[model samples]
Each structure stands twice: as structure tokens, then as C-alpha cells.
Target: MKAYIVSLAAGVAVGLLYNVIDVKSPAPPIVALIGLLGMVAGEHAIPFARMVLAHVTS
Candidate 1:
């Protein structure tokens, strides 16, 4: 639960930082949401890739 909350806060901070950097854009919120999802997916993918690599090597 705590990790989830921290992830959420980090995502929000990333989103806000992006918006601040590109204040003229109108899609900051969507970009932020996509970024959050990407982060989660990427995290899961790393271990999956590592497992695959080990299996292939062994």
C-alpha cells in the first residue's frame, strides 16, 4: 500500500513537472497518465526480460 501511494505521488510529480516544462501544451494530463502506465508496464517488463534471458542462457 505504501509503495503504491509513493508510486502515485511520483507519477503526479512527474506529470506536474512535464506540464510546467511545457506549459503551452494542452495534453499534459493525458501525457502524465500515459507516463504513469508506461512506468508500471516498464517495471514489469524488466523482470520478465531478465527471466527470459536466464532461461535462454541456461
Candidate 2:
């Protein structure tokens, strides 16, 4: 989606900037990536749980 593309572009830009500055990234890359994954999963978690609960109750 558009949001995903924009986020990816922003991340790439930040990465390039970090490389140019020769400074360590603010967070470890693996940890940051996992945190982002958790955020995406968390966004859907509530809606998916509600759908399942509604089906069960119906």
C-alpha cells in the first residue's frame, strides 16, 4: 500500500544518512526490524481478535 511504500522509502533514506555520517544506528538493526514487525502485527491483532470473538458469540 501507499503507506508501506512511504515507510520503506523513509527507512532507506535514514539508512543512507547514517552511513554517510558514519555513526551507529540509533538502534540495533535486527532489534529495530523485529520491533517494526511487532508493530504491524499488533495493528491487526485487535481487529482479528474481535472478528473471532464475534463469530464465536454468533
Candidate 3:
């Protein structure tokens, strides 16, 4: 998706900027990735749950 690509690009730009400045990420790689995974899962899960609830009620 365009949004995903743009977000990825922005993240890469920020990462490169951080690298250029010799600044470490706020969170370690593994921790940050796990957090990202949780966020993605949560984003989908909430919408899916609502859809299921609507279907069951209808």
C-alpha cells in the first residue's frame, strides 16, 4: 500500500538520520520489532472483533 511504503520510507529516513548522528534507537531492535508486531496485530484484531460482533448480532 502507498501508506505502508511511505511509512517505511519515512522510518528509513529517520533511521539514516539517527545513524548519521550516531544516536541509538530509543528501543533496542528486538523490543521495537515486538512492539510493532503487537501494534499491527492489535489494529487488525479490534476491527475484526467488531466485524464479528456485528455479524453475530445481525
Candidate 4:
């Protein structure tokens, strides 16, 4: 929860900075969010795969 709050605050700060600089964000918001979701899923996937492999071998 704390991490989520901190990330939200940081995102707000970056948004304000982008408005001040008058430049478009590198990636559209939806695309960037999807990328973040992919990263999180990928991180969990490795551990899940390892667990399945271990179970199969045993």
C-alpha cells in the first residue's frame, strides 16, 4: 500500500513536470500501464514456472 502511494505521488510529479515542459510523454498512458503490468506479470511468472517444474520433477 505504501509503495503504491509513493508510486502514485511520483507519477503525479512526473505529470506536472511534463506539463511544465510542454512535451508529450514518451509513451501513451495506456501503453505505459500495459508495459508496467507485463513487467509485474513476467516477474511472477518466473517463480511460478520454477515451482511447476519442481513439482513435475519430484
Candidate 2 lDDT: 0.93
TM-score of 2: 0.51
For residues 1-58, could you state the per-residue lDDT of candidate 4 as single tens digits?
A: 9999999999899989999999897756897889999999999998999999999999
Error of 4 at 27 (Å): 2.6
* TM-score of candidate 4 versus the correct structure, residues matched by position: 0.48
TM-scores of the candidates in the order shown: 0.40, 0.51, 0.52, 0.48
In model 2, what is the error at residue 23, expressed in angstroms?
Answer: 1.3
| Best candidate (score: lDDT) | 2
lDDT of 3: 0.92
Question: Model 1: residues >4 Å from true position, as ranges?
Answer: 1-28
Q: Residues 1-58, candidate 3: write the lDDT tens digits.
A: 9999999999899999999999997856897889999999988998999999999999
Residue pairs with clashing backbones, model 2: none
**Can you write out model 1's per-residue Cα lDDT over 1-58, one digit (the tens) per residue?**
9999999899788779878898554445877889998999999998999999999999
Deviation in angstroms for 56 in model 2? 19
Model 2 residue 47 lDDT score: 100
- If both were scored by TM-score, which would come out higher, candidate 3 or candidate 4? 3
Over 4 Å off in model 3, which ranges?
35-58
lDDT of 1 at 9: 100
